[model samples]
Target: MNKPNQETLDELKAIYVQKIKAEFPKQLKNFSDKNAKEHQLSQLRGYLHKLVGSGESFGYTDITHTARAAESIATSLMSESTKDKPSRLTYLVKLLEKLAGIVDKIEIESPVTLHSGANFTDRQSNAKLLTVGQAHIAKTERKHTICVWVIDDDESVAAQLSEQLLSFGFDVAYFLSCAAFKQALLSSQPHFVIADVRLEDNSDFYRCADLHRIDLKSFGLIIMSAFDDFHARIKAVRSGAITYLQKPINVARVASFIHEHKNKIQLHPERILIIDDDTDLSALYKSQLEAAGMAVHNLSDPRKVMAAIQEYQPDLVLIDLYMPDFSGMELAAVIRQFDNFTSLPIVYISSETDNQRQSKAIATGGADEFITKPVSADILITALRTRVKRARQLNALISKDSLTGLLKHSAIKEAVKSEIARTSRDRQSLCISMLDIDRFKRVNDTYGHAVGDTVIESLANLLTQRVRQTDHVGRYGGEEFMLVMPGCDAESAQVILDDIRERFSNIEFTVGNKGFHCTVSAGFVQLEASVFLPTADSLVEHADSALYEAKNTGRNRVVQSITARI
Candidate 1:
């Protein structure tokens, strides 16, 4: 997921602080006037609930604890508040003052963010949450095109469907008879099959008996029939067709069906961050995470929290509950001061074995998990897996673009920077590809932004299908995209990107009855660790210059950057 930059995070954090400050006094006055009324007291509890949840996340730990306490007091006094106005008023006023002070503290301590921590289960679920798995994390990868073979008896209908499917970026082949399709199946397996119920020889292609004879489980099957009744649907279902469409298949529906299946084929590995002052413990966690096929980073000094965040950008942060200079809760609070890091999952790892005390710390720290020290490696892995998985799933919603699932600008930049440094240190190969849709404005001007978006989406999907899972792809902004290829050389990267460029250009995009194709230009820089490449920014700049070279040479090509200083 694309992580927001420091400046953007700071701006968002400031905005949130101001909003809370502005709402505090208005709500405080409303509560004060109706202190003795049960309904009004209930309303006051709502405000307290907000403070309890968000206050600590933004580093206002005191407000969170105080609001929690005040909520309990308010709840207890709800029934007797009429006879206890003086006491209710006194307690409520104190809470309001405390809330106001927290706002002041937030504004002054904006830059004093510490480190975000982890997620913890509720106190009752701590034992269950810690039950780990011995199984190591497995590495995931990516694949190729959505090759669909179409079988239908109608010639015009078959041609029309093929044209539309191709326009939507699918590789489609139309065959009039089942015999021909069966022959083609022997040569190459199609990812999908769109077959008609009837054939020229009057054979039932979707008959249950026929389905069992053919290896129907090998591919996604969609059957089309003029008869759109329950009987046809049930027979199609029994015949092993996953999708049953009527005579005239909606081209858009078929495209969406194919696109969703393509997405299901993509996978990304998990990344975890460990924040423990204990070098030994941090190393242990690192070893476990790595064994499970996860990328891990460790930080001993809490002072470099923000720098670590900018560089690491982990899915989950493992925080030690106890630290001498800075407490675990303090670090978690500091990380939360930045709005962007607020949602970051933090799990507390410490030697504190007392269940009540650990639970209290977990609750107060706003952590996602609380694991006792001397815990098994399996338990740690299980806890991190469950919590981090959820965090990443949620992160994608905010970090990825609506059109392409690629990381947005800031996040992708962060990813590229980290990978460049990693590959440089390990003496590995790294390539940065900056690609742009050639004459994108012309597409929008001629067709429309909506169609232009389809072109961009097509290119994004093609790139994902073409690259390895270890690589990163992001919509760097506008028509351009940035691809970070680790363990990939300039020549190999060029070959892969050129393949995507050719495929993207060949995809016949449709606008109503008319169809047009779009092309892409890419410039990538290979930073061979042994060859002494420049800074990350320099690499990107060089790639950009090379991209211009490609555009000048006539778009729809890939160019490798010169090793010499530009």
Candidate 2:
């Protein structure tokens, strides 16, 4: 096999190290069982053989040679001829540990500048000349388009609805018949569907129910019904429609419903921000909501409420009624002024349940609903679902960047911060990294932003593909990304990130007749309970510092912060 370049070699070594660290302990634990021991020996031997073949190619000859020796001993133990089998297993385990230690000492080199790589520079040069609009056009082409199903039998209704939805920047499929809709649903697997309850026949309702049973993972469903009776609406709800809207369908209301529930359909977990001056109340709400699997952000500062909201960009904002100077009503009104938050649902949580006070709270454009204090978990969640769904609908209008399907910069920051807080409180190890496409400005300066945007999106897709399911990767800013790896330590995190770098370097991107590739630089820090227990800022700073070191050292590598000796 051909040898990997120095960069690739380092990355592979990191992966090998992580695999050894994670697998060795479990392998040892199984040693007590005779059958399990033998089975593990076989598995270890196979792994060693592969490692020997690949490790030398990545220039880790010493580690590979040791693994091969370990493999031989384990193989001998399995055959029962080796009298020192227990000792051999012990030796093998120690050798693997030694190999892991060697890998831990290897440092990731900095990424080469975008233009320095043979493929990346070409794309950069071509991205330089395009106008802003033209660049957006190119980016639009590269985005992963989500399909939406609009299932209304009325042609005029469907068309009007489709137009409204498409304006919000979604790819839409319109179906007039339930049969046609079901057929399309199989292939499209839309992110969400807007459907009418009354189909051509009663069988359509059964079909809808059937669809839910079969594709429980399908994006959220919003049903429109002509029935004014409460029982029929209740039936629709029971049948699994997240919400049932009564006709005549108001376009604005339908749009709102779609916006709020769209994310629910896609199963993006709800993010709830609780703003209360009382620490005990905040903790109470936070614990209850987290127990329900909803992400919560708690802020005790009434003065910094806006800043918290902007930072958290929560799906639902729960505020205490009374505060020192800025009351919940006042805060809601202030939030409503921002175009991005115009329809954001702000629910008041207070002791005052009097109709007059409730009416006053509701009068604030930002306050969507009021839940009296000492709110039960059930009522709170119901209010949250209502508000969050509505916020999602409002988000459809303003939150997403049309090109990448990533939350705009403002929203992404809040989401990252919330994730940081959640992971910290849960005591899970988290890896946060900042990724920058090396010399992105040069790419934009050379190829025109059109091609530049393509490269950016391609990188985003690669990051998304490479990370674990629990990880969150978002476009942080222009040409930069913020990634969160939950349940990963520094060593394990580096391995995953290095693999991403290696795979990304090999990807082929094109602009017209021109072909190109790009490399990314990342800096990451692990969240350990003892070090970064309460604050999100420290973790971010650590990662940022590491990223800076990576950029300075060279660009395509992962750097981690070194804690100072006390």
**What lDDT would each prediction earn against the true structure?**
0.71, 0.64
As a whole number from 0 to 100, the lDDT of residue 44 in candidate 1 is 76
lDDT of 1 by residue, 30-134 (tens): 765443577777877766655554454445578777887777677677766377667767876787787678676765436433222322113212432232221
| Span of 10 residues, lowest total lDDT, candidate 2 | 1-10
User: Which regions in candidate 2 have their CA more than 4 angstroms from the true location?
Assistant: 1-265, 269-367, 370-386, 393-428, 462-476, 531-542, 548-555, 564-566
Q: Candidate 1 vs. truth: CA RMSD?
A: 17.1
Candidate 1 Cα misplacement greater than 4 A, ranges:
1-266, 269-355, 361-366, 370-386, 530-533, 564-566
lDDT of 2 by residue, 357-409 (tens): 79978896358788764456567776787677766666655766655555676
Candidate 2, residue 150: how far the Cα is off, in Å = 23
